[model samples]
Target: MLRIAVPFTTLLIFSNCGMPPAECEPNSRRCEGDLLIGCDDTGHEAVTDCTALGATCVPQLTRCIVATPMLQPDAGQTIDAGEATDAGAEDAGAPLEDAGLPDAGPAVIDAGTPDAGLVCTGAFPTNTTAPAMPPYAGTAYIDADAMQATDPSSFVDLTYAGRGVRTMFDRRTNSYNQVNALLFDARFGISKHVEIQVNPEFTQAVAEQHARFYAHAVGQLPAFLFRDLDTMWIHDGNDLFGGANRNILIHVQQGRYLAMYGWLEEVLLHEATHTSLDSYHLNMPRWQQAATADRVAISDYARDNPMREDVSETVPVWFFSRFRAQRLDASMLTTIENTVPNRLRYLDCLGFDDAILP
Candidate 1:
């Protein structure tokens, strides 16, 4: 994670609030809470409470800037920002199973509970049985039409970058391809920001649409999921990939494959896990120890590529099973519980907070 460092200056302050005022040089600019504090034309300190006028203190600007979009990262960049919320029923376009209520097959693990220790006493499996389908192949955990927090009505500015030729990986061909891409900074929500560079082989209308759609979808997820995700390269094809320098490659030809299965959002969730979690947890000794203790894999894909794809594959399954169990069928839930209880336990022990998640 990157830290924003603002230089501090010492100065005598007039007694008003007991708290000391934020220090500043004659022409220095910095943000102090909701106030934009800096030197005025006379080289004296001036304070403006940006929030009082429905604005925010952005250090880059001389004055408070008002916009529905979240405040941009201080000094043109930051690692994390924003709040989390559910993608309510308003946007859910997928069919949901209403089995009255979730069946009590296996005890559900509370996501918020802190792990006491690594306690996998269950018997290690000697043989592995393959799951029927990929976790995203069956039911849609993240509703395809789920209500987006993205306010299209709000102003969106393409701050920088321009038309240029860029190399983007095409997942369908499993190779890097050269294409003219429209590159720019797209900042939305309260603080969700990412660089969207799309293949301009598609029309400008289509490019902007893809950018907004993906931005909206990604915005619906918790901010923590993509702490490392910095850029999205949108191309044309049928596959998506994440990881390697914190990027997600998206193929916009989303018709037969993604729509037929309704795995668009779920697929993004998988890739996000790669960008945000793979480096920290995937190859860790504790994770390897947990795998050894459990000796089970949730899917054939995870089993085949244990080191590369296991965490990414299992996380979505764990996410739906633990957080959205009501939307899942009993048998599927049972499969998750039986197949990878130890994996679930390992995830639980990580102490991830589903903050603001409903």
Candidate 2:
């Protein structure tokens, strides 16, 4: 019987070699002849036969480095698997540091202080509508007018009352507080199986406005991002958060942080990644490999919280560059390409079609 090898536990038997697999510390990689070997999170040997791919094994990196013909696809052309693989090799020369996580390697790249060219700034770019970088600005990438909810006026008559604890920012206290709050029965259905529950602290009018706006904005996003998201918790606080339990927490003040800022849709996308994409991709073997290969952090926030915030932080930027490139400026796009080429390519390779995207 022919057996297909799974990633993170691949066992490749070579007819010419009769050597036992060398044991190593978990998450550390090494080269064994033409084979790139690493210890997975479970301390099991994960082997990659580099010779088969016409690649060279490097002990410091996760992927076998290969030199392939680079293709420059026109703006209208779709990026193919071959392009993604070629792009991964662009930063192979950079040495990576293991951040002491199971599958995290910290990239030394800092956005604001790159060696040369346009330095990244906290100020939102004026040239395009790219979403504000998360944990940062609140500018809207997708215009408020663009994303009209399928049924903004749709309200489900389900009275859902529950006790929940979430981290909320208090403008008065000037800090985030873990508030044991009440989720009142008032709710609105924005999409199929999706509802937004507003806190009882706000008046009926305020709650309704908030619910309608949220429903319209969130409803426009690709459905796949909220697959596990059935309930959203809204309050009159000053921030937003995403929970592993498949929910998003919202605070009104985050949208009002600045007079020109407060693009909740952008923030919603960032938080949604935590709810939907983190579990599936966070510690996935391919994600780790891509991170190591890219060997650069998209932002300081991502670099600081490699395992926790990397996916959530990176996804908004990835989404903009891939699906909304027309809305982005040339310099900013160049920054993304220079900073996280491999990660961008990895996302491209995923081949998310209309089924997952809108």
Candidate 3:
């Protein structure tokens, strides 16, 4: 026999060459940079680069752990991932607390409903009709028959509890028909309380019946300018004058009253101011003297009664020409400012100068 001698160590290695590799427990894994080195189901070591699967290994879990992205709120805000529960000293799987990490409390969140009144939709209702007027028989000076004979449709009755006013149009001409538009403009243009409290009545018949007629009769002048005049007449419960009751009558006719003159809303606002001031008896003789001493008249009408008409005339001018900056004839503005510097000063004193332009 041929001599084939082998060492004992060589013989042992040769005997185990056909056997499989050592096996590991389930989920056994380790981290290597961005890779996951773990044991597969077959007990073979497998290499998986976590970066290839859009993940990174977290060293806290020891095994190949993947990191989860956290969402961020607004600037300077932080999100709480939640507090880690303590597993107690008896649990073997509990993670040790890191001494470098700060203690965190539970996050607080507000979840209350808001009040309904706080919401502003900016929706306002449209006003269609004027308030109704109270019943009143003509006084000794006012012919009840003629006043009653005036067309009902021509009158816009406005009433608010104890106070009431009837705004009648010119029965002779169709001009009064346009009073509705003027009223509509005035209603929205000024304060609701002021516009309603002023309670001005426009009636050519009433105006002519009283001594306070238009400067030029409706048919007497050109169709536009001199034809329409808004006359503010004082009335008692009965007569146009010499009455203790404080009431106002506005005499006007239709046809471009606002466009041609730029006066409708302004004039209404002016007269309403007058009605408001009249209650305080601010038009006393002393007040008149002081006004005359300080301010000059703006127009011939205002000149006729400076103390009385100054506020009315200048109010509209100040509101439209000055405050609102509405385009007006330069000459007119200059004339008003030059002639009635005192009136403007008076308005300033009364706080009327601080009008907020619409």
Candidate 4:
């Protein structure tokens, strides 16, 4: 039996030395006695058997290589096995940290500019001229002839005509005409300007025309008391006129002309006394104080509202005895002087005694 014995140490040395080198310097490779020894291209540094990994060595690359192809190298350049070529290298001047990656910072954004247009140059204009005068002058253009030709009294008579009961003294078309005439008579009978100043507009309507004269007399009373009489219907059943703040209305049951006129004229001065004093401060608190100081009233009406009617009622009696020489049955002046002496004193303070008598 011609058997050959091999040492285990020598067999181990042969096994390792026959393996290829995975990595090599440029243009270098491992070699054995009649064969080339190379490594597989596994991107690692290992001594691998080329035959076992099915790879070969390339002297031009100087590496143990595989049959798998790589990217072509640049002209006149060589690369080592298991080493990256310029084919997959970063750009020459690019940052190595950002290789094969997107930019890791904020992007730049652009915004454009603005434009402005037209400007004003000229100065604003203003008015330097004066305004013109008004065209129509007041009252100067009014025609006096046209005004006088139109009678104002006739117009007033026409307004109240046929409004109420017609009296014996009233005309067919003018209801207050007779009353207006009596007012004019009473006006002139007292003084020329008395009607114009005291009661300029006295025409009014009544239940009958014969009552017109009496209505004119009642119109001569104070505006305030007259208002009270009208609101209270003081003369509703009598033939006397109902009083208003501005006018009067007479209640007439009988149609006697001259007789009614006589009675109205008799009372005209009495009511006129009230109208005259009323032109002063008859409605003031001072008048009330004077009436209170009197302490007694002259008539039933004065007794009822001494503060309101005392002065009107007392003044008339004083006037009749002092100026008209008419005898009153009530002897009201003597009664006022005896019972309420301050009443006489108040009338004297108002200069009524001198004013009526003188």
Candidate 5:
């Protein structure tokens, strides 16, 4: 009887330089001195399961090969696979600290300093409808006349809820309008598996209208997995801001919620992803929750929470860029892969892979 050799645990191997058995049916054609690339995460090496533990084996010549690092850090960045994230246990939702640590509650950024409430702000380019998601009028149940104003300038007056006693930040032309679009798309995607609810606390009057649309869009999501969507766009007149338990509260500046809404839309999709994960599985640590969700770092929420943001950012990036036309830099791609080892799991949770983000 002849058999094909399986990969062995040890990198080095010693074997007689004899031709493979003619009846063995070699896996591939061979060369006199062909080099064998070690198996790693990028691809799999054909092998036979010799034992129940699924031990792999393969015949080798007299050479010991060093195990290559599974993940290689790019320049100026480091990849630490075993470095567990500092989250969930005591610091589940702790605020990010400036000194590479997390604060007890939340990080406070005085927003008004970023830009004038009416103009596009932040370091990234702004004022482009290309990134602007369409306003949610009929879809998310947004108020048509209000949230979807014809004159884009109407977005200038939208409210944001992130500011505390300190000053707030300004947003772009159609922040809230675009945000409504993102929320609608994400909600619909995740609603397939998990029951979901939305709570929009818009502090601005125009944003209040968008909140209404958001609530309306809730009904449009898959009825089976989604139980309901609840929104609170209007402030209860409360100024305090921090991470809340069981729900993700976005803090857009009052009067800038519209433009900020565009920014917040990505975050909303990310957070809402948590709800979907919870429905599919049991209670997991916040860090793992974000990891399984596969969010990326481009969004503000994901950037602040690197470990958790992995899934939240990944879904959007993959759906929008990889499967869709959107493109992400090499760094972003690396983050996505290292974050989630199982592509099937990530793609499975997000529903169909094509036409993911718009």
Candidate 6:
């Protein structure tokens, strides 16, 4: 009865692509008929909160950016990013179904690199949309032309490949502001397959330091594709490296969610490390092997309910924090030791220099 996610406690159904159930947000069944906002050209009231949050806080003025390329938004309905919310409102609709193909498992990428390489530099698209994105989100297409035009071998760069994820999940995961936006940006740069090849010698060194810190829990992170990291820096509208933007995904927390910044970074690194090492199992798709390898990586908070979720955020944060210019805290280190086991050595068997910094 929540968003398309259905909140099965652990499982998320993705088989159906039909319109989502218009009842309540996932994990909650409170009524919201009065909190709805926005309207279509045909005079039909539009729901600003498809996930049944509070209400649209901004004015819903429908405006299209990029004007649309392929598979345009519906003529009557506004752009997915156009809707805003108020405090209390709910427009009734049908029961929502699953969002995307559900378990596509990150292997749908077909286009390899083009003839001329280096064209991929400055090529990874910073802003774009997928074709089948929900009516509530932004355009979901990944600009492949920009990719081929820049670095052809950027194929290993899962940033664009993972672009489809935005269209898959129905709700936000805390990307409503700056810090959280950076978190999403950071995750977007890597993949669930492999996350160790983080270039920029300093970053890699930081990762190694974290790896050593959590050596007991076995932070066996996978190596990234190549030495040349095809990185996409999400530049907030501030100075070259500061400020924030709207490209961040909005994630809604359920209960007892860990929102600490340091832990979140460890999760990003660890999960991104999973994305990097994930490529090793190309022989078996959907990452059954990769997911199974966590026995070594799983520990501490990782052993908690859906500890995988916590590990995905906490491991990287703890790892990265250890190497921060500021002295890393001993409590955070213990948090890693107790909650997560070190698993970086497993990648060493894959011919990855997990011990060495990028």
Query: After TM-score superposition, what is the CA distance of residue 139 in candidate 2 from its true location, in Å?
Result: 11
Using lDDT as the yardstick, the better of models 3 and 4 is: 3
Which TM-score value belongs to model 6? 0.24
lDDT tens digits, residues 14-127, model 1?
223566544546445567776766552234454556666556666654345454322221110111223222222121111222211223434554434333333434333432
**Lowest-scoring 10 consecutive residues by lDDT in candidate 6?**
1-10
C-alpha lDDT (0 to 100) for residue 187 of candidate 3: 15
Clashing pairs for model 3 are: 175-254
* TM-score for each of the candidates: 0.57, 0.49, 0.30, 0.32, 0.30, 0.24
What lDDT score belongs to each candidate, Candidate 1 first? 0.53, 0.47, 0.29, 0.28, 0.27, 0.23
What's the alpha carbon RMSD for model 2?
22.2
RMSD of 3: 43.2
Cα deviation of 309 in candidate 3 (Å)? Answer: 2.2
> After TM-score superposition, what is the CA distance of residue 69 in candidate 4 from its true location, in Å?
99
Best prediction by TM-score? 1
Q: Score residue 241 of candidate 6 by CA lDDT.
A: 11
User: Ranking under lDDT, best-scoring first?
Assistant: 1, 2, 3, 4, 5, 6
User: Which ranges of candidate 4 are over 4 A from the true structure?
Assistant: 1-239, 243-248, 254-270, 273-276, 279-281, 324-333, 352-358
RMSD of each: 21.0, 22.2, 43.2, 66.4, 25.5, 23.9
Q: Which stretches of candidate 1 lie over 4 Å from their true place?
A: 1-161, 177-179, 239-243, 355-358
Error of 3 at 242 (Å): 16
lDDT of 1: 0.53
Q: How many angstroms is residue 64 displaced in model 1 relative to the true structure, after the best TM-score fit? A: 54
TM-score ranking from best candidate downward: 1, 2, 4, 3, 5, 6
Q: After superposition, how far is residue 339 of candidate 2 from its true place, in Å?
A: 1.8
Candidate 6 — what's its lDDT? 0.23
